[model samples]
Target: MSENNKIAKELVEAVGGKENIASVAHCATRLRIMVVDKDKIDQPKVESVDKVKGAFYNSGQYQVIFGTGTVNRIYEEVTKLGLESSTKDELKKEAGKSGNWFQRAIRTFGDVFVPIIPALVATGLFMGVRGLVMQEQILGLFGLSPADISDNFLLFTEILTDTAFIFLPALVAWSTFRVFGGNPIIGLVLGLMLVSPALPNAWAVAGGDVTPIMFMGFIPVVGYQGSVLPAFIAGIVGAKLEKWIRKRVPEALDLILTPFLTLLIMSTLALFVIGPIFHSLEEVILNVTVSVLSWPLGLSGLLIGALNQVIVVTGVHHVFNLLEIQLLERFGNNPYNAIITCSVAAQGGAALAVGLKTKSKKLKALALPSSFSAFLGITEPAIFGVNLRYMKPFIMGLIGGGAGGFLASIFGLKASGMAITVIPGTLLFLNGQILLYILVNLVAIAVAFVLTWMFGYSDKQLEQTNEA
Candidate 1:
């Protein structure tokens, strides 16, 4: 038998046979299973299975980490064992059952933001490359002046860098519509209308280069380029309106009228009503975030860095995307990314300490990769699979993150963009502050490592260390 098949068989037995599983699915690094009876599973045996880095029950599913490529193979084999499988949508429905209203709202925020993150990340990387090529030191090495770069080439680069944020409303609206069970195409149309060329550009209007259109001789309207709240509010209104219309319209006219009316009404509302109110609200949020960042003594940084990971654990952290986007739009830089990167790195450091100190083979296997994942700016593995399980390591990470963030704020560290961190994040700081970025990360890691090694793990837990 193939190794994957062999492991699949063992895993099924470990979870008390195929009958115990209601459904199963896999994401990039984990197999998520919803079991019919938790009592039937042998948790120790599951951890001991080969190729399993770690396993934990969270959000109502048993998530078993098998790394990137390995998860697909294991998932294929598990399905062949006659265990029922679920689509991602089905899995989401099952997982959604566990959280409270607040928790569910947070998960929904995560759902909306996560889909759009890849576009943002790619754009950030593109900006990094542009910044790198524009550097005077690099250009001088090639005997080139800043003017040596052609205007056409610069314009092309700007297009690549600007496309994502320029149409961010469409992406946000599409994702939100999907979440709220509306036709995503209609959502896209409504979003596009919010930024139509007929309206003055949001930035142009703000810069006084163009005047805003007066609506009903009282309200002002402009394009929602780089705006967050308008698209989000429009999406919810559109989706709920679409659902309501679908219920009342005849089945024969449902497809045409529902979509047409939804788009028509939503576009009008978004441009005149929802857009103005939420744009003002978004501005308020942006100002509040800036004021907090500017607070005395790095106090804001210390507080945000300590509490950020805790928010991440609750999955509500994606809401900060609004603030980050606004910060980048107004000031052309983001200190928030720098502050949060410290917190993410601290979690990795704490996990690494646990890996080094633990005698349990199962735990060591879990901690090492979880730590590496955390450093790469994905902390769910480290947070849920290792640090939180050991309680003390999680707290140590919080302390270390706060210290690192305080220093970062004091040094005035800032990033050119959002959504990338630690190693991949180095690209964002290549504008002459790379050394400071490295130092901040090192401080976070070292502090967390020392704290975890000193007080995070217990000798008693070590004494109880058998492989499983």
Candidate 2:
């Protein structure tokens, strides 16, 4: 058999043969399998299989990390073995049946927020570039002052940088509705209403430049530009309300009355009830997050950085999306991104150390490429493939992350965006913080590399793992 075919066969046996697999699917970097019985699988053998970078049980699925292109080939081979084929979305539903209530909630948040990350990343990059070009030093190099810059050009930059945040509610609501099984277009319209031109701007109200409109002479109302929680909650309510109304409305009127009643009731409740209550709660959450990140001597950063990867292992790190959104909305920068970047970079460093120190060619090949992947901001390969496989390396990485995060806190390092981190994270720091960002990541890598090289790896352990 070919090498891929061999690996695929071995993987099937390792996971208790094809009979134990309920369904199989592949994403960009991992072969995700829903297994019939977890207790029947041979976990160690699965990890030791040739060309298999790593394997782990998560979200009720046995996810085998085979790196990017390799997974597709292996997945094809696995399917050739008479396994049932499935899509990633279907696999997600299968896995979704296993997590606890909290995990499900966190996953829901992830489902909603993850789709919106690309727009935010693009907007952040635009903001960074605009800020870079508008710098006094940069302008001086062009023999021009701020006054010499064209108003139309500045207006263009504003459109690129501000549009995403100004319509952030719409994005959140649309995603939430999609996740909750409601019509996304209806959600989009509801979100737009929250930020309608007739409403007082939220930022303007905060700045005391505009007064909020009063509903019933008591409830102050303003636009939800840059708001997340209100939009998310409103989306959930509106979707459920629409479903409820749809079930009751007569078939003849279902097309018209359902949407009309849903919109009318939801709009009133969102403005008068959900918006006011949830926005206050969002502010409270934002305040608490700020307080934690602002703790004395960077203790909060140290703890967060040290534990960030640990959280990732549990598959609940998506919960951070709320904190990140809050930070960006409140301060226009994200320190959490800087701190977590250190944690991610540290994983790369530990994996790199193992790759350099290992006598096993299989491990060296896996570790080296996975480590590089970590540097580019995707850490699953490095974490599962190398660092966690060797416990000492994982702990050393945590320490390195903590050390780098301490420095990040002391320096007050913040990124202009979220979603992207590590090397690609440089874009978020382009607004005059590039040097500090590099310094923090380098420190994380160096600390993890030195510690793991000195003590984390051993040929003896590799021999044992292979023997298993």
Candidate 3:
């Protein structure tokens, strides 16, 4: 058999053979398996399987980390063994059945926001580039100042940097509707209506440059340009309304009448009710978040950075998606991204130290790649495969993260983006904050590495692991 085939067979045996697997699927980095009985699997043996970086039980599924590209190959091999193949969406539904109401709600929010991140990341990169090229110092070298640049060129840059955020509500609404099982096209239309050109621009109204149109002589109505909660709630309500109308309408008129009624009712409710109420609620949430992050003496950064990896272990870290989105929407910069990068970078550092110090070749092999993965902002392999397996290293990483976060807050470092972090996150800092970003991440890594090297790893621990 080929190497992936061999690993696939070993993995199947490790998880209690083919009979115990109810279904199998793969995401970007994991081979997710829904099992007949969680108790039947040998956790250690699964981790020991060659080419498997780590394994964890999460959301009622056994997720084996194989990194990108590798998981697809192994997944194909696993399916060849007669196990039922499944989609990631199907696995999500099965896993959703096990979580509590809060977990389910958070997962739903994650589902709604995750698909919209790539557009934001691209926009952030464009913003960073625009900032770089428009710098007074850089423009001076080229015999140009801000006024020397062409208006058309400036307009083009604005288009690149501003379009995604200007239409953010539409993206959120579209994703939310898709997640809630409505017609995505209808969702797109409804979302477009939220930011229609006919309405006064939200940013302009906020700046007192324009007045909002009054719906009933008292209720002010403006476009939702960078809004999140309002659009998200509208999507949920609109999707449900569409589904309900579809069931009641006659089969002959279902296509035309259902959409017409759904859009009409949802549009009125969204503008007069959901939009106004949720927008206020979103502002309150933004205020609370800002207050927490602005705590005296960098306490907020220290706590969040130290605890972020711990939260990741609980499988609920997706909740940060909303906070980061809100921060980017309201402030146009995200300090939370800078703080979390420290926590993530520290994981890699601890894993690197363990990899270098470990006497066991098996562990050294696992730790090195896992550490590299952590530096690139995906920490699961480092956290589960290396650092957490050696408990002291994980704690050392937390300390390192806290130290870096404290400094980040003191420096007032922030990113122009969200979703991406650690090394690749440099793009978000290119707008004049790159130096501080580098310094903070280096501090985090150095502290974790030095601490872990001194006290966290030894051959004795390997012996204990083998014995267990």
TM-score for every candidate vs. truth? 0.92, 0.97, 0.97
lDDT of 3 by residue, 292-386 (tens): 99998989889988998999898788888878878887788899999999999999999999989887888888899999999999999999898
Off by over 4 Å in 3: none
**Cα shift from native, residue 431, model 2 (Å):** 1.5
| lDDT per residue as tens, model 1, 441-460 | 88988899899999998656
TM-score of 1: 0.92
Give the range where candidate 3 is weakest over 10 consecutive residues by summed lDDT: 459-468
Q: Per-residue alpha-carbon lDDT of model 2 for 1-468, expressed as tens digits?
A: 899999999999999998899999999999999999999999888987888888998888899999888899999999998999999988887788787898888777888888898998898788778878888888999898888999999999889988888999999989988888889999999999999999999999999999999988999999999999899999999999889988998999999998899889888988889999999999998999999999999998899889999999998999888888778877889999999999999999999999999877888999999999999999999999889987999999999999889899999998887988898989888778889989989999999999999988788888876632
Runs in model 2 with CA error above 4 Å? Answer: none
lDDT (Cα) of model 1 = 0.87
Give the residue spans of candidate 1 off by over 4 A: 1-19, 37-48, 359-362, 465-468
Per-candidate local distance difference test = 0.87, 0.90, 0.90
TM-score of 2: 0.97
